[model samples]
Target: MTAATQPRSVNSAAADDVAPIVQRLRETYARWTRRTPIEQMRDDWDELFRSRAQPWRINGFEAGGVAAEWIMAPDARANRTILYLHGGGFRMGSIDSHRDLMQRLSIAAGARVLGINYRLGPEHVFPAAVEDALSGYRWLLDSGVRSGSIAFAGDSAGGGLVLACMFAARAANLELPSAACLMSPWTDLAATGATFLSRADVDPLHQRPMILSMAKAYLGPSGNPLDPLASPLYGDLERLPPLLIQCGDCETILDDSVRLADRAAKAGVAAELEVYPSMIHVFQAYGELHAARQALASAGRFLGRYFTEQDKRPPEGRGDTRDCG
Candidate 1:
């Protein structure tokens, strides 16, 4: 679609608009994961993006018959908490790979983030991830953390989980967070987006057939891939908190975020969508990328509005220089 026709703004001259650093990132991801197996892909991710931040304490907890790592900022006693879910296509990724993003988010949101290391698929499949997410939220509530002060965030598959958790939470009559944010979220696990094929050549990380293979592995012989919990784009979107979604224009999964915004808007949920030109999937992982910095700054501004701070002024009071767009 042309930039003018799109629901949100787009830089059509993305080739020239994108920074050289992002170009290098595309090259790096292509070189690193070319023809690699899913397991090796996870290992490579660990080797490449592993956080060097000093290890902080995470109170271990059990939920839904699985163990989860809950990382808390040292000053969490006063600040609020965010429950973060890491994305790896339901078969990969861990809290360790997402540490940097979570740390940045914690600082931006003025809250301690609890990153959950949920169980993967091919062995645990479908409802397992959703069950773990609900269990984690329940644990947070049961532990005396006020629900209104908690926010949910995630990327890719984790993004889908955040929405699923919202669905489950509403069903159970739990209090919701003030707002939420998603980065390059894979809302449609069914891989039904036209971009999956249209942008195949440009998308660096994901390929349609390969992702379908992984989904099959996770679902096994008798699983429904289009189930709402698995593909939350197919689920109900009403009653969700205000949500901000950041996506890259060039990624194969771009349609996932687009469809989500459309669905959410149709359901009357407050949704703000931002699409960065010529950006790759989860480009925020490369902190040096200009688009990554822009996306993070956008997320920070959005969070700052919803997550009020005791000493800070309201977003409107902040100078216009901080505007994301």
Candidate 2:
């Protein structure tokens, strides 16, 4: 093959390697969505997500006085911390289900990570998660961690909570964190995004019925999906910290990241969005995959930019940057 075609050929081979894994995941998602009970799903997740190796010295503690767990690598970086939120469509998910992902993130970012076990829906409802997220931030501040040294990160519904926390912090006049990173963020709880239908076939995990079900479970009869706190896509994004959003083109919520970046830019925040080809929602679950590993490393570097003391200048207008992988 000519030199010009070499890169394409290698990429093609790498993609082929990932195809079987994606197919297996898609099949598994379909099975779970069809037959799994909501309560049982938590246990199912615990069994499904097994860590290959432990990278952090894990411990449970009261973060800012709220029940939380901290995962720190052996040689952790100083003055850097990540407050992570786990995703389960607001109804499920816990620190246990997300430990592996958090461990990988801690290793990649070289920072201390706090995974807060926020209250879930069907019992706590809309503002409960919001309240917990804000409280976690408050605890972080009370613990003497400077806002500039911290970053907020999450996946799916937890990702939405990250944005909600930002809004809450801004309104409360709390100093904002240095940056934020969202993975396959379910920003629009209303399930109105075009990708919900367009990418339905490609995304094995989420479906219209399940998506709407989760929305109702979280919002209840009184909650409004358009409330910026609940659905951040409708929120004011002006003056927010720099944001990095990563999503797979095949995800049902792909537009959530896309429009979020656009809205953040229109409001003048430095936002970067990356759309990975042939990947599904939260593909970072497969740390073994080259694409997922690359995505996580990129995410680490993006958050690190803000954590670095020397790069704290105010972001400029319409930093609407996009990258493809």
Q: Whose lDDT is greatest here?
A: 2
Per-residue lDDT tens digits of candidate 2, residues 1-325? 2221111111212662457666665655556654577677666665566445365445776665457887666555656789999898887778877888887888888777888989887778989999999999998887777899899999999999999999999999999999999998999988888888899988866787788888888998899989999999999999899988888878888888888888887787888888878877887877777877887888889888889572344433212112100
TM-score of 1: 0.81
Per-candidate RMSD, Å? 6.9, 8.4
Q: How accurate locally is residue 72 in candidate 2, as Cα lDDT from 0 to 100?
A: 64
List candidate 1 stretches off by more than 4 Å. 1-7, 10-41, 51-66, 70-77, 308-325
Candidate 1: tens digits of C-alpha lDDT, residues 1-325: 3232244644542333445645554564675444666677677666566754447654455543456555544443233667788888788888778887876676666666777778787668877888888888887787666776678889988988898888888889998877888988877767999999899987766799877877786666777888777778998888888888888878898888888888887787778888887777777776766667667777767865775354253322211111111
Candidate 1, residue 51: the lDDT equals 54
